[model samples]
Target: MPSTTGSATAPLRVDARPELTGDRRIAVLLSHGFTGSPASMRPWGEHLAELGYGVRAPLLPGHGTTWQDLNRHTWAQWTATIREVFEELSATHDAVVVGGLSMGGAQVLRLAADVGDRVAGVMVVNPAVSTLRRDVRLLPVLKHVVPSFPAIGNDIKKAGMDESGYQRTPLKAVHSMMRAWPQLIADLPQVTAPLVYFRSATDNVVDDSSEPIILGRVSSTDVTRVPLPESYHVATLDNDAPTIFARSAEFVARVTG
Candidate 1:
């Protein structure tokens, strides 16, 4: 695991109170995808801060370094860091909305399920809970045999946008992420907070399967699904990112009110 829960490289954290919204002090804590650093979520977080909301995008354990480091860390290390960030935000802000990209999205959902109403809302872009790949079933046995494979990051439709994620997919870390999916899918009903889901219409990385599971299962009556017609997996750095930033701010205002 990385020495610090979140290193300072390209970190994004802004403390601001809205001059244009409700009386509640709200903050948005975002998490990056597996093998991804804070760079991916920084732009979105900055946009929220410009709108006068406290924003935080923390680097996960075993990220921002070599793929070998990621393999050494399990899903537990990543989840623990997210849990720590959420608790701190909840203590400081009147309300906190948790969100993320890819695996980061699942981490936030787990927190929402555990903490229930304490999480004001959720905003996920290209979140992955389960995969259609049959090879994944063999991860438990294959992870020891094979260390890693090609990365699933930077699947953007934009011309030159880069997610700056790991070049290799660490088997141990990825297997750990998928291992939590079954339980999370079952606990989806426990997440009752308002949800704003953004998914790229065509993604080479994540399929359309997880969307139905999340949209159908989460008990959030205020669920809103926004399809990114022109983007791919890393929608945060793609053409539709503005829409995500704008709508997410609105979501915060509505739920935190």
Candidate 2:
């Protein structure tokens, strides 16, 4: 598998035709994590697509390729890529719901803040935001000294997937995620849409600080938080993934109803 670095190189495109939008059904844009591909969210996307919603699980910039490609891009480029997909989805559907797994979660939160009124709701699964802990702070420094550390949870799911395996985990890419965390945390207060937060109780990567940050910032009284009992960092593909997908479908249904 190759790493995507947001360069001028052509992307590994997945064509999701707007087959259900003729009846003016809702649209949902599903975003993947930092080092992950659209395969992470395709099951959930297909679930929603089957429920009369148009779905698009776009491959984020610098992903579905090599880790070296990811190292070449920053958070800004990745967010812009998701944003462009959202804009296009919104143009064709009666309503739009934005959601993501991990970093894709941050992009949707920023999108909700930037265009809350335009979005119907948001659903985040094990979203990563703000890595201020001493351990994460030391990662940037360690990268300089250590040649390469295989990123934790960089493996892809073999079930219901249609893409290459996990690509490279670039040190520069991880550092960029750390840098973007603060801005995402700072901008959370501006979001006003209904939200569903799925947290993996045993997630090894993201800390628990995200719960308070999300609860304190969002203005929606209808926020729902569900704890995944058997999942790790990538809850969408973990042991309890079915639960996550069901909750996500319910969240979108509630908001769009």
Candidate 3:
């Protein structure tokens, strides 16, 4: 059976070449969340690719690995990597649309703000924009005084559903995300591309505050919010994934056309 646990040494690759032709179609750059691999975005990318849209899902830095590896990298590294991928995709295709899961979604928002004119549209799934509470403020202290493994399983209710099954979340990694949150929140108003926001009703990772923060702040004239009622934080791999894939395909088609 194929490994569902993901990998640290080996990164997941999107089977994108088969879907690409010389049609000069719109390009789609898919980004995964913090601690996630390109595999997380593969379904959406493949679905878009099948429709003759060029799709690319690049693995973020320090991801597809153990939590310790993730702790070693900063949010900026991941953002830079995705930005480069977005530029490459935009240069190669006629129109460019960017999408991501969780933190990847946050990064995409930053990308839209920083390079709005270069992008045709944006598709975000459970984009994390705000901290659920000030308690996240404690992360900085915990990373030094406590071990990350002991507290790892406490946050996850559906252990069986964790594709990576990571029991050890790098304390520093969670802290890094928290630090990045403030900047993403501040940059929300700069986004000018048409936006498609997908949210999971049962998500435990990102709080409900995200919807208002994104919907109320982004400057995009066309902002569509779709609720994923059947999935959790990793909705891309859960029950409503097909909905995400299909909706994303439709959104890409409409925006890029």
**Which candidate's TM-score is highest?**
1
Clashing pairs in 3: 8-65
Question: What's the TM-score of each model vs. the native?
Answer: 0.94, 0.84, 0.86
Q: How big is the RMSD of model 2?
A: 5.2
Q: 64-112, model 3: which lDDT tens digit per residue?
A: 6666777788888888998898777766667888988888899899899
Encode model 2's per-residue lDDT on 73-167: one tens digit a residue: 88889888878978887776678888888788888898898886799999998777765467667777876775345665533233443323244
Between prediction 1 and prediction 2, the one with superior lDDT is: 1
**What digit string (tens of lDDT, one per residue) describes model 1 on residues 2-70?**
112244336677885656446566889999988888888977887888777888888788888889999
Return model 1's CA RMSD, one decimal: 3.6
Query: Where is model 3 more than 4 Å wrong at Cα?
Result: 1-22, 147-162
User: TM-score of model 2 relative to the true fold?
Assistant: 0.84
Ranking by TM-score: 1, 3, 2
TM-score of 3: 0.86
- As for TM-score, the candidate ahead, 1 or 2, is 1
C-alpha positional error of residue 181 in candidate 2 after TM-score superposition, expressed in Å = 1.5
